[model samples]
Target: MNNKRRVTVILAMAAIAPLTFTACAGGGAAPASGGDVKSLTVLDSYNNDPDKGILQASIDKCAAKVGVTIERTTVPGKDRMQTVLQRSSSKTLPDVLMLDNPEVKDVAATGALSPLSDYKVDMSAFAGNSLDAVTQDGQVYGLPLPADTLGLFYNADVLAAAGITPPKTWDELKAAAAKLTTGDQYGLAFSAAATYEGAWQFLPFMWTNGGDETKLDSPEVKGALQLYVDLVQSGSASKSVINWNQADVKDQFVAGKAAMMINGPWQIPALAKVPGVKWNTVQIPVNKPGQTPTAPLGGMVWTVPRTGDKAKQAKAAEFVACTGTEDSQMALGKARNTVPTQNGLHQKYVSEVPTMAAFTKQVEDARSRTGKLGKDWPKAATTIYTAVQLALTGGASVDEAFSKAAAG
Candidate 1:
């Protein structure tokens, strides 16, 4: 699934009424000893094809390696978290669970997940940022698979035709976007919806400019916000961005309404189908030459939940570990169009999928949305998108937008 779907699922899950837990319930029951585990229950939200099929192949391989039969339950992304919460309350949590990276903390905080350390799952191969998302109180709760992050996807044909090059800095982006804008087409397109997806899209610009989520109303943030304001005001980007999700932005890019777009690798499959468009991706531009483009990390993590059955839990951990192995990572990454979380695989992965070079580089330094704020990230994400909407729609000036949104 795309990060937009991941964000929407998280936000939807957050809206549900909070559930309280007793020490025994929250901390998970003591593991029962001595039982043969034949089948393990697994739950995740890969309900669509390609993702669904690709994930199933991995699961089947892992299950065979772990000597267990899998009873997997797939739900729509929007409903997975809610289902997890419901199951948690009823003491029927799946033996294995898959959570979006950011949601790991919230679920782990509730003691619904077991630390991977408990099973001595080896994590040395995974990327630090990917591990950071699933770590709570210094304990890792899950294993991340190949991940995705945002990038600047441009129509190479469009850029060549306009005598333009892919932008490398914010100033150049603004100029290129303006130069590309003409009748019925904008120079650039991006999601600025009043949702976490918008907050996510803005992160590269915000972080590259030295803005922090904890301090959203500062000069650095203002500069980032002003880029959005300027794009809309100068007619280089659609005013309709405030209503567009990432999918809508991709549609705009695919339909020739946008010369370039800010999106992620999850859109690759659909873009591949449109063979006529000569598209390519680059890391989102930095504000200045020295700044590193820091995009938000995107992907789900496979976690072993606190199911109270030691045998099942042990088998589940083995399964999760198998999924993180080098062979599994490469296979899944290739099949799903994502980057492997394993370290030292960059050169090999890039050599295999040349078009993913920019994204591979981006994920190397990508930051997790919940890395600093943990469960409180949803609130900060809300503040960000609210600010974007206000600034882009003239509800407030760029300088005033974050402050006003924070106040509400």
Candidate 2:
């Protein structure tokens, strides 16, 4: 699997704290006229095969359309922001930059990125939350590409043999999980590690239960935490969850130790390699019938940096726009196992890739983690995971977990 596509929330949030940059004042390359541009520099975190190649194809297609060669740089996801900061200070920022959506606001706040609006980039086809991911202070900072969200991945064979259907509500989930549990196998598996990955895994349950991140100690949030506690206490979920990451959870599922897991489409390639698994996905269940399952949107956004070259910036903007087009989105979505961020393409995308139907549906109501709290999102994420840890480990009761974690 490509590590770049699986960046944890902690690394992303940590990189933002020291990203102060002076947009156009850096002393490196002189401004070049629009006519002088013949090639554009691009930087992104798709540094492995498959994803690297998949993204390159899209970049190449866009490069051809814009009539310019692309000078690209691929970094590991965790190093992406640091690279940007280093390049920005040295006035060598790439003309086109790809940012993990959650990091967009912090980077934009530093004046390191050019507003796509200034180039008249058409963003009408994108999802509202996708746009919100890159929007800061009324200005659109970047264009989002294909996105992903959490889903309930089940071993079809296990569920069928157990006479179970995919769960749709909290009560159903608990019942199904308990019924599926057997000797040395957990009915449900999810990450509860003390990291942003854990917080992300918890979001669907929290948000669907009407829990707000800003008010962590509220009844709604406690209800969500209690669900986690109940599962572990009942042995429906393993106590090891508090130590496992998403990748670990997937491994457990693949080994048949877990019947279902909370994960994303990025795992599709890995799952495909294990033909014996026979897995399928569904939207994460809501707390009740009327509530919506709101998972956090996961993907990167392309931006034009203030590289002090009008021609290169214009060409880069064109390339960025090209990548977000319906055709480009469809191509990337199919090759990358991601859902297109463009509106009106979900059904069409689903028609083409049936396995992605559930995820596509989830993206419709999914939100950006930074949408509500922006830079402060990391703090909330930390609180969430801490509460989960406390409750699951018996350090605190469900009713006191969030409040205690918040207080600390």
Candidate 3:
């Protein structure tokens, strides 16, 4: 699975040698003359199987269409930035690079990426948040292939047996979860681990309650944290959430130990394997009746690196463009279990896969994790998850957790 990174570009310039390129065309590196470049080298973090194979199929299709062979390198998700930095310093950066959306701003800030507009890549189809994820200082550095966001995944059989509809508000969710609790199964499952994954899970609750990442110690934010603390304290959620990641939450749900879980579409493939475990998805519940369910956008984007060869870079851009087309998006989405980022294609996608309707609706209200904070987001995300872990583990009260975490 491709885990998203909340990027913080605190690297020294000496570590990743600065590209001495002039920003001649709309803040993008002008493609230099390197005649008849016949092949493209690419870098990405889709080393895991199924995703690796699935992504390569799209690359192969685009490479064949562009009449060029592709030389690709795959790295582990957590190591992708380090790989890029090392490659940048050595001047061995690939012709095309794939970056988690938040990482795009950090990399683009270093002038190592060429703006897609320079190659005339289509910019018409992306949604506002999708476009926002890959843009920095008014220049688009990358194009998202698609987007994913958190949702409430529940056991349809469990909810039906309990005579409960999917929750629409926090109060109802609490009641439903309490009602569903029995034996080893908890009312709900979620990840509150001290990592980016935990922060990703918390965003919907915090943002829906009007909590701003910039104001980490505010009452709105503390109230959201209280909800998690309450869940665990009331035995509706396991105290083990302080250590579980999204995958673990999904496991609990599939094993009949959790009636509901907070996760994203990426879990669809795994959930589908167990035919007996009937499941359905709904938008994450709101804190109150009229509030929208806001979630953090998840996924990576394709970018063209400043390889000092305009011809190869432009051709690479064409391949990047190919990957974002509606057909290409849907193909990869179905194969990898993600939602399309294009505004118009979302309806088409949901109509074809009815299970994704709630996810598609939630994406409209979703914001990029780094949208407001930019490269500094990783710092804030770390604090957010630290507080989540602190509160859930009873290491500190909700207010104390946020205050102490933010203090550091």
Residues 150-208 of candidate 3: C-alpha lDDT, one tens digit per residue: 99999999999999999989998899889888999999999998889999899999999
Listed per candidate, the RMSD to the true structure in angstroms reads 11.5, 11.5, 11.5
lDDT, model 3, position 310: 73
TM-score of 3: 0.90
- Give the worst 10-residue stretch by lDDT in candidate 1: 16-25
Model 1 Cα lDDT, one tens digit per residue, 57-105 = 9999989998999999999998988999999988889999999999999
Ranking by lDDT: 1, 2, 3
TM-score of each: 0.92, 0.91, 0.90
Candidate 2, residue 234: CA error in Å? 0.9
Per-residue lDDT of 61 in model 2: 94
Error of 3 at 132 (Å): 1.2
**Which parts of model 2 are misplaced by more than 4 Å?**
1-34
TM-score, candidate 1, is 0.92
What is the C-alpha local distance difference test score of each model? 0.92, 0.91, 0.88
What lDDT score goes with residue 318 in model 2? 86
lDDT, model 3: 0.88
Residue 163, model 3: lDDT of 97
